[model samples]
Target chain A: MPKPNRSFDKSLWVFHVNTGSCNGCDIEILAALTPRYDVERFGIKLVGSPRHADALLVTGPVSRDMVDKLKRFYEQVPDPKEVIVVGSCGISGGVFHESYDLAGPVDRIIPVDVYVPGCPPRPEAIIDGVVKAWMKLERLRGENR
Target chain B: MADEIIHFVEIIIGVFLVAVFGMIFGLLTKGIDRKLAAHMQWRVGPPVIQPFLDVKKLFCKENVVPRNAVAWLYNVAPIVCLTSVIAILLYIPMGSIPPILKGYGDVILILYLLTIPSLAMVAGGFASGSPFATVGAQREMVLMMSYEFPLATTIIALGWKISTLYPGEAAFSLTTFTKYPVWNIMGPFGIIGAIILLVVMILVTTGEITKVPFDIAEAETEIAEGVFVEYSGRNLGLFYLADAVKTVVMASLIVALFFPYNLSTYLGSSIHLPSIAWNAIDFLFYLLKLEIVIFFSMTFIRVSVARFKVDQVVKVYWGYLTLAALIALVLIALDILL
Candidate 1:
């Protein structure tokens, strides 16, 4: 796949997807948008619809019931999109790793470009993760060129 | 025949220039609104160039057409919406200058043109075949119906007073408004009534542009961006531009109707500036007026209020605001008689 253009790099509209997380990570994601962090200064807005998003900020370990819905949401985002998996649960299922209804770690279900690993990552870490995603895009763009 | 041809060329050039100006100024105003709103909330907001960058990024993204959508209608709607808004700018005066299509249309014509963008949005939503969009479309129709009454009453009240003052003149022509500023024509009672009408128009503007408080149709949290849920990429960018331009149109309308005073008129003889300098000063003053109008009617209100429910929007516009407008009309009429 071709790398996203420079304009996409400048303005990243993200859609937050929750896959049965314990609400901790999701709250941190919301915190990233509050004035304390203000992701909007970097042109990173939380969009309501996946169609309008350039990135998917997926939280939670994948629960069995949410896997299909999460996949559907990912497909809804238009091309030249990145998926950033947030929270420890999304990476290794954390406390829910051996739970009965578990289907995640999110990377098993979809290609993940960045991982922000904390029980609930701090807003600063979340912002850092986004910047990492930008660097990945830059690297991909260089490879394509 | 030769004269007609020359006139036609002038019109073509004028339309092109107006379209470009409308788009640029519209986006600029939107950027200002965001910056002002952010400051009001005690945060450093996105830069003024954010909207321009957004439109550019949107253009670069992939266009996604939903499987269930009527592709042709879905694609055509944004183009139509933007065109209609630009057309409204043609009829409404800009700064100290008359409208490009001044003689051909009037306030009444503008009233009709205002609805076309919303209607086009409704049609586009329905064609998208999404349930969320359908609900948003229905709310938009209801919101349109609710606002039109007060909007029409205010326009008619102004036109009625102007016609009474000058019997032989075209009652609804915008030129009449420029000739006889509403403040100059009114007595004490009429002035109060005119202020009420101005408030009604400002409130109507919040609805007309579908900003926060009246933005039930596109309540992102509730309906996932509603009528625009299925739109992406280039189509969404067009809608974004349409919205920005519509802001300019709504603010300009308020300026034309109530605050059409030109700086050049007041400062021309006093200051020994040249004609071009005078025009430039007047244009800058007009921009200031636009910023103030937008700040009060859009940015301040948007920051202060949460989105109203669809039913509450109807109640606010139809029930309360319409009555307020009617009272203003009555007061204006009484002023004329007394």
Candidate 2:
């Protein structure tokens, strides 16, 4: 096996996109920014635009209507990017699994580097997922570049 | 002439002490803002000593300037910002100063000096030649243009009111204006003018200091720390210090002009202390009042509202504020005639 890359371990820019879920997950995502969770100390930024982002932090189940928008957004992000499924809903549609409009577990539609498991994972866990995604990105970038 | 010379020396010393006071309050106000911002989000903030820790660490860090940066100006930007902010402190009437540089307190002079720090930062940003810094400098230029009109109007309205009330008199000096403060407007139109002036002053103060809702130049999410993006270590720290000092200076201006409450009278005007001691106490009173107003007014607005877009900010000043100021002028004129 080829050696793994780790350069993306330095800083990861996260872009958060809400699909279709209750605000519980969204609140926790912002909680990651609070003093206790303070992610800026690590150089991780919650970017407002996808173009500058290095990772996609998707929350909520992929809704049928949002499926195309999500794909378009993912396309806009530059290559050597990584995707993280941040909530159980994003992983397998969770409670919204039974909804008629449910499109997917995001991994089915996009290549996922890490799956952060929780109805809403603790911010530390989300940070871990991002770190793992960065590891995967570093590996890919090392091989390609 | 001898008395004037003695008074001038006293004013110089008074201004130096006030500058020191402004720096101290700048740091404390930042601590308070951080504590309050944390409380709003339901978390206890860092200890009040946190800002001190941050500065200490920044000082110890290795400094770096990008290879493309204009070496000389890049090194000079933060110093210019800091010096100009301190210079502004001299013109602001915090208390009874002995009158050194008293002649420099023309409202127009004070207004122009207020622009120097930001203008210096812009020059510094462009000199850095970084893409993000360039964008930040451009945004700052737009923001300054947007806010300056309303700010100018607020000053003019205050000057106009004093002129109308007293007639043909230039009561534009900080010491003179604060000495004879306008507490309330007597008539219906006067009240309207005063209220409008008060609101615009509050908004413009927030704008001039580049606080949130007006902080587009350093919008982290959009442009990645903006003009200061290229600055690191001590250079960055100086800009931060200048920013904190500007907050106090801007707040003091608001209080000196609008909320003119004097503390010496409360202690009994008959009881006199050393001139320095009296000035010190008055300075403290001015700071306390400024802190309360900034916390209750500007910081509250900063935390509660999301930032407006650049064009939106421009439209607000030109469309709403400019018209509001014009109305205030007409009302003040009416107060004079009838």
Candidate 3:
């Protein structure tokens, strides 16, 4: 396990990107920040621009139209970062997999460090996934050594 | 019959006003969540009025139902959900007035009451008969099955503890329990049990609310707006309002359970303060505490976490958290016996 006070994993910032969602996942994602399931209590934030983000929260199937935008966002984020695909769509192309105008299942395009797989996962589950990602980041950095 | 009619009318008026306030409160919380999330990421989010505007726009738009839908249920579901969500607020004790349904029962009724909107969604989805709606309803049923076990276990443990703490209490009311608060009790194991139960309850509550990572039933990307696939215009707007109101009702229930504080208590003596002063102070404290709990305990979690897979969620609740709760119950029972 990485030491309790690992600097790199502690202050991770997230960017929420929607490739082609019907807004259910997006609303649930917003629900995370609501008074009911606020995740900020753990210091995880949702960043707007990927350039400054340490984590990417991709929600929705990667539509052909939005694939370039998603790739651009992912590449812009600095290295040693993590990507979290938030809903089933982001991971498996979900219901949208059969769509004619799609290039989804986000991992095919960008590396995903964690997969939170509810239609839209709960806030606490999301937190657990992010924490898992942080640990994953530590493991990748070989910090345990 | 005459007296009952008057009482019923009074309740109707009271619930109507509370429902209106609940909507306003729900929208404000939504805005706050957006603003906070935006600030967390260092960007300017939309104004708080955005949700209201969106809902307003939805209202003005044309209403549409799928050609094959069971028109009555599709149209009626949102109203039913919204009404039930508003009705839930009546059972909770916001501040003073004991509880709207105190004589009827508090948590016992509230617990079952909380499930109504979700049930409405399920029924509505089934009525639509769309592929997306059908899948969404199936997910909703499974999700309900997944969380209800843990939630019920937690509530039972809480109810038993509350009853044990105050023996000879006839009513299993949450308002009564809150009127007397649980954290003040002694015994190390009991405290641990309470803390463990509280954590489990928070998890179960979040899951029950269908927010964040727990939101699989209506997951738009996965199920094409899930249960809401065929709804549009005012019908869609009502469901939105119902969902929002449910959020408030759930948060309020938690506050009532774990942290019911009366500001009049802080005045040192309830009798010393004038009746008006005591009432005002008590009301102020109640609202403040509720807001603080929402901001700290609930919304904070929403911001920091990601979503979970359907099977993973089922595993987490039944496989892991359920065991934790059972063990905690065992410990609490042991403590009580010893």
Candidate 4:
């Protein structure tokens, strides 16, 4: 395959998914889009459909009931896409790590390009995580050639 | 025979130029609308070239056809939608240039052409075979029916006054409106009627273009991008371009009908500049007018209001707006008789 073009790097439309976690990270994700943070300055938009997305911004730990749905959502996103696992719950199942119904630490279910670990990462930190995903995209472009 | 051949060639070239102009200016207006909306919210928006970058990026991505879709119809609809919008531009004059196929079409023809794009979208949504798209398509059809009555009434009211004023001419030709602007031809009562019609027309424009408060068919939060739920890559890009061009068409139609006065006609002789310079000046002024119309009708309205439910959309257009249009029609008739 030829190198992935960098044209999409500037306008990254993200699809946010909640995989059975507390609403903390989801609120922060919305906060990142508010006037104060305004990630649109860097061309980051939260699109409603996965088919239109360039990156998947997943929140919450994967629970038993959400495992299949999360995988289905990942499959729906088209190629040349990246995944950003947001919130500590998605990274290590957070406080739910010891629960019997826990099935996550998102990397085990899907390939994750960036991990934004916090009980609920601050809006600025979420923006930083998106930048990290862009860096990974650049590195992948380098390797493809 | 020779004259006919030359005319045919001129039309072909005119169509090409109009298509190109529509795409460029349409996208530029969309960029401006976004920036103005963002600023209104106290945020620094994406760069003005953001829409261009987005179209480019979309073209490079994969085109995905869903398994259940009617593949041929799904693929063909975007082309039809975009082409029909360009066709409407051919009938309506732009700035100082006469419409490409001027005598071949009129206001009624332009009205019919305007609906083709939305109908194509409805077809595409139904062909996609997605439940969300099916519901979106139904709402789009309902909205189209609701708005067409007032829109047709506004055009007919203007045409009626023109016919009464000049008995033997082509009353419905768009050129006639530019020639005898409705504001100049009527009595005091008629002017009030025209203003009410103008307000009605602006509100109809809101529904025609499907911006916020009127965009129930594509309510992203409720329907997941609604009619566009299944589109991806180049197909989505085409729909985006169609939308931008349609905005230009709607704004230009409003300008041509109510505010046809040109700066050059007023200031051309005073400045003593060449004719070409005057034309350029008029075109620039027309663009400024278009931007202002789009900002007030689309951008400001979109930012300030939330989406209405599909039922509420139907009620607003059919009930209140249609009644307002009828009252304006009656007032104009009274102005003519009394």
> TM-score of the candidate numbered 2?
0.71
* lDDT tens per residue, model 2, A3-66: 2234235445578888887777778879888778876445465765454456788888888988
Instruction: Say which docking band candidate 4 falls in.
Output: medium
Alpha-carbon local distance difference test for all models: 0.91, 0.76, 0.73, 0.89
lDDT of 2 at A42: 55
Question: What residue runs in model 4 are displaced by over 4 Å at the alpha carbon?
Answer: A1-4
> Candidate 1 regions off by >4 Å?
A1-3
Say which prediction, candidate 2 or candidate 3, comes out ahead on lDDT. Answer: 2
Taking the tens digit of each residue's C-alpha lDDT, what string does model 4 give over A6-106? Answer: 66777899999999879999999999999999999888889988888889999988988988888988887877788999999999989898889888578
lDDT of 1 at B292: 96
Q: Which 10-residue span in candidate 1 chain A carries the lowest summed lDDT? A: A1-10
Q: Which 10 consecutive positions of candidate 4 chain A have the poorest summed lDDT? A: A1-10
Model 2 residue B75 CA deviation (Å) reads 1.7
Candidate 4 lands at a TM-score of: 0.97
Best by TM-score: 1
**Local accuracy of candidate 4 as per-residue lDDT tens digits, B1-338:** 99999999999999999899998899899889989999999999988878887888778777889999999999999999999999998988766767899999899999999999999999999999989899889888999999999999999988999999998879999888888888999899899999998888888888888899898778789888888888888899999999999999999999889988887777776889887877777778778888988887899889999998888988999999999899999999998798
Worst lDDT window (10 residues) for model 4 chain B?
Answer: B261-270
Model 3: lDDT of residue B271: 60
Cα lDDT tens digits, model 2, B173-286, are 776577667655437787788789888878887878887888888887788778877776568668878988898878878887887766675674688787668777876787
By the lDDT metric, which is better: model 2 or model 4?
Answer: 4
